[model samples]
Target: MTSTADIGLGTAELTKIFTTATRIKVCDEKFRSLILTGQVSAQYYSPRGQEIVSASMGAALRESDYMVTTYRGLHDQLAKGVPLRELWAEFFGRATGTCKGKGGPMHITHPASGLMVTTGIVGSGLPIANGLALASQLQGTDRVTVVNFGDGATNIGAFHEACNLAALWKLPVVFLCHNNRYAEHTSFEDGTSVDRVADRAAAYKMRGVRVDGNDPVAMHTAAREAVARARAGEGPTLLEAMTFRFFGHQMSDQNEYMKPGELESERANDPVLRFRAALIEQRVLTEPEIEAIEAQAKSDVKDAFEFAEASPLPELSELLTDVYEEV
Candidate 1:
C-alpha cells in the first residue's frame, strides 16, 4: 500500500489541475451564455463545481484508453484533448464539430481520439463501456474503458444491469459516478435510500471506493490505482466521486429548491480556487503564473466561440449519412 506521505503530487502538476478546473468553470459559463442567447439549441447542464473529477481522471488516462461520458460531460471531453473550438462548433451545430454538427452538445464523440461516444440518456453509456471493455479483452489489448455518469444515473435500472454484467464478465471497466448531491431538483436521499452509490458495488461483488471528488490529488491517486488494476487483469471497479454541481441541472432551471446559504457554502470550497491556494502555499506556483494561465485559457475559449459562430451548419444531404454503414 502506498503511504499517504509518499503520494507523488508535485507543485507543478497540482497547479495544472487547478487551472484546468478553472478552464472548465469558464467553459460552463460560456456554454450557458450561448444557450441563453439562442446560439445553441440544447439545455446546458454545467458541471460547475465537479470539474476536478473529470480533469483528474482524464489526466490519469493513457492516450489509448477509452472514455464514455454523460450529457453533462464537457469537462471529460476537454480533459481527453478534444479541441475547444471543435466542441464549441458542435454546440453551435456547425460542420467542424466532432460529430460534423449532427451530434450537437450532448452527443459528442471522437472514436479516433479514444472517446467512444457521449450519450444524452442517463445510465445508457454504462453497458456501452462494458462492450468496449469486452472488445479490448478479446483483442488482447490493455485498453481500459471508463464510464462517467451522475447521481441520477445511479438510481436507474440500467445502472444495476450494467454493473452486474461488467462484474460477471470481469471486464476491464471503471464505473465513475459523480454524486453531485442532486438529480435535477430532487435530492439524492429523496431519489434513493442509498447513502453512497459505491455501496451498490457489493451487489456485483466488485471493488468499490469513494473519494472526495473536489480534491484533484485524491481523484488522481484513485484513478491511477483503479486504471492500473484494470490493465493488470483485474476486473471492474466502482468509484463514486462525492461532488456538488454549483449550477442548476439545466439552463431553464430556476434552482429555487436550493436552500439559503447552501450554494454559498458550496462555492466556498470551489475546487479551482482551493487547489490554486494549496499550490501557492506549497510553493508549486506563483500568483503571476496562475494569472498567466487563466489569461491564455480565456483567450482560447473566446477564439472557440468565434470559430463556432463563423462555422457553417451541416449540409442538407449529410443528414441521412453516418446513421448506418453503406452496404
Candidate 2:
C-alpha cells in the first residue's frame, strides 16, 4: 500500500498535477465565458469543479495508455496534452479542430495522445474501453485502457456487461466513475442503488476503491494502483471518484434543480483551487509560484481562443470531404 506521504510523488510531479488541474479549470472557465457571449454557439458539458480527477488520472497514464470519456471531457483532453489551439478551433467549428470541426466538443478523438474514444452516449464508453483493452491483450501488449463515466451512466446495461467481460477475460482496463453527485441534474441517491459506485466492482470479482477525487494525493494513489494492476494483467478495477460539479449539466443549464446551498457549500472544495492552496500549505510551492502557474494557464487559454477566432471556417466543399458513404 502506498503511504500517505505524498503518494511517492516528488515536488515536481505534485506540481504537475496541480498545474494540470488549474489548466483544465481555466480552459473550461474561458469556454463558459465564450458560451455566454454567444461567440461559441455549441453544446458543451463543463467539467468545472471536477478537474482534479481527470488531472490525477491523466497524470498517471502513459502516452501509450488509452482513455474513453464522455461529452464533458475537456478536462480529460487538456490534461492528456491535447493542443489547446486545435481543441478551441474544434469548439468554434473551424477547419483546424481535432476532428476538422466535425466532432465538436462531444466527439473529440485524438489517438496520437492515446485518447482513443470520446463517446457521447452515457455508459457506452465502458464496453468500448473493454474492446480496446481486448485488442491490446491479443496483441500481447500491456497498454491499459481507462474508461471514464458519470454516476448516472452506471445504471445503463453496457456498464455492467463490460465490467463482467473485462473481469472474465482479465482485460487491462480501469473503470473510473467520476461520481459528481448529480448525473445531469439527478442526484446519485435518486439514480443509484448502492452507496458508492466502487462497491459494484465486487460483483465482477474485481477490486473496488473509493476516494476524494478532489484531493491530489488520494486520487493519485488510487489511480496508480489501479493502473498498475491492469498493466500486470490482474483484471479491472473500479475507482469511484467522489466530486461535485460547480456548474450546471451544461453551460446553458439553469441548474434550478440543485439543492439549496449545495453549490455554495462545494465552493470551499473546488479541486482546482484546493490543490493550489494545498501545495502552498504543504510548503511544496509558494503562493507566488502558484499564481504564476495560474496566470500561464489563463494566458494559454486566451491565446487558443484568439487563434480559434482568427482561424478560417471550414470550406463549403468540406461538407462531403470527410464523409465516406452516401446516406
Candidate 3:
C-alpha cells in the first residue's frame, strides 16, 4: 500500500474513507470469531488483506451508482453502505437480513442501496453490471456500475464476453478485479494465461490498469478514473487491483497449499494498519481519534450481533415466497 500524503485528498475525506475501511476490517475480524467459535453455521470469505480495495472504491462511488459482486462479497457489501444490523442479520440468517435470511452470505441483494445483486456464480457479475449500466444510460443518468470479482473469475468465459459487450456498447461500467493471486487455493499462474490480468483489457478495447489493491491511495485513484470514464460515456475500465488474503478461500480452508512464511509476510504489511499509520503521519488524524474509531467499530459490531440475535428467522410461510412466482 502507498502513503496517503501524496493522494491529494483532503484530511476530512481521507479520514472518513480510512475509518470505514477500518470498520469493515474489524467487522470481518469479528465474523471470523463467530465462525471459529461455532456461533454460526455458515461459510464466509474473509477480506482481511483486501479491505482497502473496496474501501477506496466505495468512497469513490455515489449512492445511485450500481454494484454487482460475487459470493465472496461481504467486504464489498459493507463498503457499499449496507447497514451493520442488516448485514449481521443476513449472516445470522434472520428475517431482517437483506434477502430475508435466505441469501445467507452469497446472494445478498439490496436495491435500495444500489447493490443490485450478489451472485454465487463467478464472472456472472460483469454482465449484470453491464445491464445496470445500460439502464442508467437509457434513462440518461450518468450513474456508473461497478462490478467486483476475484482473479479466478476473469478466466471464466462470461468475463471476456461482458467486457467485449461493454466496450462495444460503450456501457458505463467499471470492472474491479480483486486479484488476491489465489483462486480457491490455485495460484494465478496455474489458472490464468496472462502475466497481468489488466493486459487482457486490450482484447475488449477498454482502458485497463493495475494498482496495489492494498493501498488506499492507489486504489482510490484507479477507481476514480474508472468511474469518471464510465460516467462520461467513455465506456468501461478494467482495474486489476492486486493484493492477498490472509486466510484461505473459505473459513474451513486449512491453508495447506500456501508456502511457508507467505502468510506471515503478507500480514506484516497489513493494509488497514498501514492506512491508519499513514493517516497519523499525514496529521490527518491523531492516534487517539483512530483508537476511538476502533472502539466504536467494536461497539457497532456488538450492537449488530445483538440485533441479529433478536431478529426472527425465515418463516415457513416465506419459504415458498420470493421463490417461484405466480403471474
* CA lDDT of each prediction against the hidden true structure: 0.85, 0.88, 0.89
Q: Candidate 1 vs candidate 3: which has greater TM-score?
A: 3
Decreasing lDDT order of the candidates: 3, 2, 1
Clashes per prediction?
0, 0, 0
Better structure of 1 and 2 per TM-score: 2
Worst 10 residues of 3 by lDDT: 1-10
Better-scoring candidate (TM-score), 2 or 3: 3
* Model 2 deviation from native, Cα RMSD in Å: 2.1
Query: What is the Cα-based lDDT of residue 59 in candidate 1?
Result: 75
Q: List the RMSD of every prediction in angstroms.
A: 2.2, 2.1, 1.1
**Among all candidates shown, the one with the greatest TM-score:** 3
Per-residue alpha-carbon lDDT of candidate 3 for residues 1-327, written as tens digits (9 for 90 to 100): 455556687776677678788888888898899889988888788888988999889988998889999878877887888888998999888999988999888888998888889998888999899889999999999999999999999999999999999999999999999999999989899998899999999998999899988888888888899999999999899999999998899988977888898888999989889888888887878999999999999999999989999999999889978887789
**What TM-score does candidate 3 get on C-alpha atoms?**
0.97
**Model 1 per-residue lDDT tens digits across residues 109-217:** 9876688899989889999999999999999999999999998899889999999988998899999999888887998888987898989999989999999988888
Error of 2 at 206 (Å): 1.4
As a TM-score, model 2 comes out at: 0.96
Model 3: pairs clashing at backbone N, Cα or C within 3 Å: none
Rank candidates by TM-score, best first. Answer: 3, 2, 1
lDDT of 2 by residue, 194-288 (tens): 99998999999988899999888889878999999999999899999988888889876877888888888898766777677677777788999
